[model samples]
Target: MKKLFTSYLDTFKGLSKEIWWLALITLVNRAGAMVIPFLSLYLRDDLGFSLSSVGWVMTCFGFGSLFGSWLGGILSDKLGYYKTILLSLIATGIGFLGLQFITSFWAVCLGFFALITVADMSRPAFFVALSAYSKPENKTRSLTLIRLAINLGFSAGPALGGIIIASIGYYGLFLADGITCILAGFLLIQTLNPKKAKEVDQEQLVENPLAPHKDGLYVIFLIALALFGVVFVQYFSTVPVYYKEVRLLTESQIGLLLGMNGLMIFVFEMPLIAYMERRGWNLIGNVIGGLLLTGLSFLFFYIEGWPGVLVLGMATATLGEMVAFPFGNAFALRRAKLGRQGAYMGLYSMSFSLAHIFGHNSGMQLVNSLGYNLTWAIMGLITLLALALLFYVKRRANTLKI
Candidate 1:
């Protein structure tokens, strides 16, 4: 145990102070991520929208995310990540504060679209900032540290959100979300002085940087990423509803169950990533394994009636997430050319946005029509398809030597 603890600590060494500050800002912003986890529930129960309507609203959210990601990348490159991040956080905060006022279905859809567009604009900027802060040698670990902060906040957020929902109601959640985003913006201003920090030399990182759009192999990787995201995002989108309606779990129980994913990642992901990095494992192989595990996680839903299945599935999915996300992010970052990091990261973020666009609505529609078991089966099949594309990407990368 002592040796294991030491290894975990070792994983955190050598990351920049700026990365820590970035992680802190991420933690603060994500801790109020109470809204997304419970958005479907709020739409259905509080606003009295149909499940179909909820799905449509989520689809709009995805579109907004896609646009935001693209814009953020452009802005990061032009305005600098520091300014772009501040703009996103402050604007998103105000957007969230106004979101609660929209009650009608179409208005809610528009509200979410606008809100998410402003909110997700930070994602690419955040990635660019992270790349600027971290050294080449420690890039993966730095990514993991930021992810750790995100998961830790997610772990706390849902639990606290459940309590808030029980007491003051969903309005409280909106308030918390809005306030925290603004707070994070202010904190970033106070903490990270981009002018003073010694940025990693980009010229040394990539000798010949390829534009993300022009790179065929990277595009294939992005396709696979989108598919993986489709399966993975179900946890945030449809799985909560599944827990409540099918598994007969209460809000608090569901929150705890979802929180388990974050807690597990927080406890185990860093050391696991460190061990893999030390072994010099192939990034593509790690991602494939993670996607396979994630696919199998959904299959566990087949064993219905027992609440234990939910726990088991969450554990499997969390493990898959831990394995895939950091490495996948690292791969994207490494693949980026020095000058075009924003474009690369923007496209990467955009892939997940595509997943969000399709995944939520499709899962909900499947559940509404075909039943939960069939929906889980379909998600597994989708992952299989993603895996196939990834294999092709691996082959192409070898052929092109990218």
Candidate 2:
């Protein structure tokens, strides 16, 4: 264990100050990630929306993201990551503010799409900024650190959000979430001055313009990863409704359960990644193992009567996330062509958002028609197919003479 600790230390050896600040920014922004976790609940319990309506609203968020992710990449490449991040954050906060007033089905759905589109547009740009701020050897570790911060913040978001809802009500939740997002944006403005950020962007690779759409193998990889995302998103879309409606868990109890995922990732992700790297484990193998575990974790939901079993399942899924996400990010970063960092990463981010669209829509429909158990079972099966395809793609990815 001590040796593993040392390996974890090794991963952070040469990170720049900028990288640390970026992580801080991520933590601050994600800590306010209170809205999405309880969105289905809010719509269902508060506004009396059906599960199908909740799913459709969530899908709108994803659809907006599809556009936002691509546009964010372009802006990051043009305006620099600093500006793109700043603007997206502020816009997203405004979007949430809009959500505070709108309750009609079309109004809420449209607001959410606009909000997601603006907010998510920063993702690719943020990826580019993160990559630029780290040493080449520390790429995966850097991404993991950023993810660690995200989860750490997420750990707090749901629990705190639950308390907020109990104390101040649902609109208060929207207000608080909006404020923090905009705060993160302004913080970027204060820290990443134009002169400093411009110099940094000048040193980075130029845009590849056509790489994301044109690269055949990378496109195949995106499709596969997106499929995996379709399965992954059910954690937010369908799982909470299941817990509340089927298992009769309270909001606080539900918060604890979801928070468990973030907490596990916060505490264990880096060390696990460090251990795997030191052991000289193959990344493709790690990804495949993660994917299988993800499938099995969802499959564990088949154990209907035991809450402990569900906890175990969430724990297992976090382990899968730790394995797959960093390696996949590192893989994408490595694949970016000269000058196309923003475009490629944006495309990658877009693929995941696209998955949210499919996942929410389909998962909700399955819930209505097939019952909860079969819904989860089908999701697990989808992951199995994705896992197989990902393995084949990993082999192909390895052979590509990039």
Top-scoring candidate (lDDT): 1
- The whole-model lDDT of each prediction reads 0.90, 0.84
* Model 1 misplaced stretches (Cα beyond 4 Å): 205-209
For model 2 the TM-score comes to: 0.94
- Tens digits of per-residue lDDT, candidate 2, 1-402, equal 999677657767776777777888888898999988998899998999997898899899899999999899899888888889988999888878778889999998898899899988899988988887777767788888999889988889999989888888988888887888988888787776655543222244544345667877778777878888988888887988888888899998888888998999887888788777879776667878887788788877777777798899899988888898888887788777443888899999999999888898789889988989999889878887888787777788678644
Estimate the overall C-alpha local distance difference test score of candidate 1: 0.90
The sequence of per-residue lDDT tens digits that candidate 1 reaches over residues 1-402 is 999788778889998889999999999999998999999999999999888898999999999999999999999989999999999999988988888888998999899998988888899999989988888888899999999999999999999999999999999999999999999999999888676666874546466767898887788999999999989989987899988887788889988998998899999999999899989888888899999999999878778668788889899999999999998998898788643888889999999999999999998899899988899889988998999999997777667666
Candidate with the greatest TM-score versus the true structure: 1
Candidate 2 global Cα RMSD: 2.2
Any idea how many clashes model 1 has? 0
TM-score of each: 0.97, 0.94
